[model samples]
Target: MRRDRIAAIVGIAESDIGVTPDKTVLQLQAQAAVRALTDAGLHTRDVQALFCAGAWTTWTNLMLAEYLGIQPIYTDSTNIGGSSFEAHVGHAVAGIQAGLFEVALIVYGSTQRSQRLRGKVPGEVSLTEQYEAPFGLPVPVGAYAMAAMRHMYEYGTRPEQLAEVAVAARQWAMQNPRAFARDPLSVEDVLASRMICEPLHLYDCCLVTDGGGAIVVTSERVARQCRHKPIWVLGHAETHTHHTLLSMPDVTSTGAAVTGPRAMAMAGIRHDDVDVAEIYDSFTITVIVTLEALGFCQQGEGGAFVSGGRIAPGGSFPMNTNGGGLSYCHPGMYGIFLLIEAALQLRGDAGMRQVPNAQIALVHGTGVQLSSSATVVLGRD
Candidate 1:
């Protein structure tokens, strides 16, 4: 009934995530795509499908397919804010199951920090303008700031609780050489940092970075011959609770509340089976809210769940081992990084950051003030 699904993530690659002043967006995408193809031990001619996403750049599937010198039997250019990459994975899976393509490549690149590309203005009233942009909120930090303030008022979530997320992420980053923010931080450090919005300090937010990442997916039969073991996509789902933070019924919970169970059920996995988690951390509050919605803890226990050394390196749950968006490079949309980290861990390629016997992983992406949500269950075959 599930269409006898067979997909394998054979390759993963990324450029330096923090500051890439030397390369164009296309160059970055090409580099990651090439690296992924090499990792899979496949040539460019083997690809039959292509998918891409971005805001300021014209990321066309055809252009990439042509650049890579492959004739795609199918192509997708779905762009849904920050959740685009995660959504792309679902679309690729559906396309593969429908017999539309045998192999598909998903790629994303951004130059926001280096190129200084200002995304579509929040207030610009075009058909493409986001509804929330009409209000004074333009950037993601402002929208998330509103939610953080509400959590503080309603659940008595403290600044230290928020700071704890940053602190834990930084500690993990120190162990990851590719992580951009390896510096140690404290609650006092976060509190003393510059204020982007009330109750949301600079350290509470993610970094604006320039980078790219890509992954290759193919039928399970073809994956057996690849260079590495396939990280199977056991289950995946995407949902939207609200298009804007203002319309959210409750900012405390996320669309993950709806999507998480569906994905896990599809995979026939329980919460206890997940050995690693790569939850997106666009803002400190984002991770806290997702933890609760994903059933890591009770509705309002996110503060206490992360209070002790639980999410740290040697804690009960080792999260964001490559550092999350909180400590890793956030090149505009950071969802792709989560997928890369999850796949690497399942493949046991995470080196010193590797969790012991990581057999299953849960990777989540939060896009546009928790407007769009995606969840994926990955397991080792």
Candidate 2:
């Protein structure tokens, strides 16, 4: 396969980003799809492929394509939780490379927080749930909390170090109008926030909002005529270590360790070559472990890598510049938001959260219990 045919992202947008109760799931997806099409100055007829991770409905890819009145030549519905969108990007690139599709639309939407907002978990019938749910694994928060505890125990990481991540996210959120939690935060403030689970404060967790996002991908031949400057899909990879927390190889490590190197190698770049990063932050622990797993630092050094505001604004490297799922909107699966933020940075349209002259971006997504992972390297060069 030729690498030069990797798809380019020409259009991206998030519709009804926060607290959208009145909108239906399809409405949210359609609004975002239309906006992204408008952003690229293209029409639905131009979309040769469609992909979606619709958590709310079945046949989501077909449904969205029908709603948009687009008869796609190809489609994908690879539901790998939050990393689905990143995986869709990888599939679209491959499809484009193989001449299977000329243009593709990847979209996501969720009403998990608005209409059905309650203590609803992933139900009691998944393959992994069969094994873990019997023991009441607390689904997600408790699982992540355990990871935090282990990380702290193994690396001597302090709660203050984790607090810094929330504090820095807020600092970035203050500049993003679409962020769900923009109030200024401090390490002490995070420390003082009500504890959701041991070692993981409420501030350390992501927001529960109703929102949706969409991205339009196209081949190099077609992207040249698009409206925005093309953001190249340089390289990408995805993997998952386990289906349940108990099955996870190690709480301190994730699939990013493998996918990161694979992606960078395909992109022909090193860690230092990345100008910005948009990593999943379902919880502060996710960021810490993922950073270490992705080779940003040695294992267990993630606590110190983010210490003293290295990931905050005006720091050596800006992370989750969209306020992340921590301060920004986390409407169930948050992988799509990571891609949108990276595209914004590469396009020099990030406004106050922009990293100056950001040429390359590393976007990584993690799913439930860190069971699913995906990494993508995007560049303007």
Candidate 3:
């Protein structure tokens, strides 16, 4: 049955990837949507399903449909923070399998940087704020700071190990013409940078930029007519361990532990089959924790696993080939870009940063302050 069912990515693109104050979020979303549809050799009228997420607009799904003049029979606007788009991929595949929709469009856009809109801070809605916010718990970076400290205390995960993740991302960024941060970086350089929160230097954080990206998913029947090679959705799974940092069962571990193995199993492959990985890197600690959970290494061995140029540009395991959120554009939710890059790698279209004959790619997205996670495995036909 798994072999009989198939959903493939037929098109993908990005719009206004860097700072663009002139473009509103909806404009960015529309731009990416039209471009992605064009990439798939499709028009707005061909889209039967739509999915979008962001605080850029209320009812983001409806706004995108209206802007594109599309009337979709199915729509999804689920907002799970950074992992929303990866979850969208899983949903779109299920939609195609169930005959709910033939062609689905997933779009995302955010002006968090050029427009200086960080959206609502996480508080007052969860137990974290009820008990943790009173103590002035700075969201995201601050929460990640706590995780970094804990990882160090538990796994002997040094600040230097954290720096390797950032350094590797920048190395890949230098090869990306669209990357936001392409400057040379090293562990020593990262260590020398100013510290925002304890143990997390400036380089340990992800970039802030304005960007919009989109991907078109369709059943194999429609994919056969697309302009580009179809990147099949081999398997995928989504999971969330907690809504807030305080509620997290373990800072050193994440939902990737559950989603990764489940997705890999569904894909019928081992970790070694993946030619590249596109794990979310909102923070350096995110990459380390996620890699460990995904079975890349033992629980506390992420430090050693990512070290010694293992995940670097020319390393054995290519990761974040589009520079990831660390050096690439991070317009609020970054999961969309992860999917875009994975599809590109599998299609053998990733210029400069392309992994040689990359056949299988793994994409993982971390949501909120490392509370939610989603893993999707993609392959070329």
lDDT of each: 0.84, 0.89, 0.90
- Report how far off residue 346 is in candidate 3 (Å): 1.0
Candidate 1, which segments miss by more than 4 Å at Cα? 1-5, 118-123, 127-135
Whose lDDT is higher: candidate 2's or candidate 3's? 3
Per-residue error for 367 in candidate 3, Å, reads 0.4
Q: Name the 10 consecutive residues with the lowest summed lDDT in model 2.
A: 117-126
Candidate 3 segments whose C-alpha is farther than 4 A from its true place: 1-5, 119-128
List clashing residue pairs in candidate 3.
none
**TM-score of every candidate relative to the true structure:** 0.95, 0.97, 0.97
Q: Lowest-scoring 10 consecutive residues by lDDT in candidate 1?
A: 122-131
lDDT of 2: 0.89
Give model 1's TM-score versus the native structure.
0.95
User: In model 1, what is the error at residue 289, expressed in angstroms?
Assistant: 0.8
Full-model lDDT, candidate 1: 0.84
TM-score for predicted model 2 compared with the true structure: 0.97
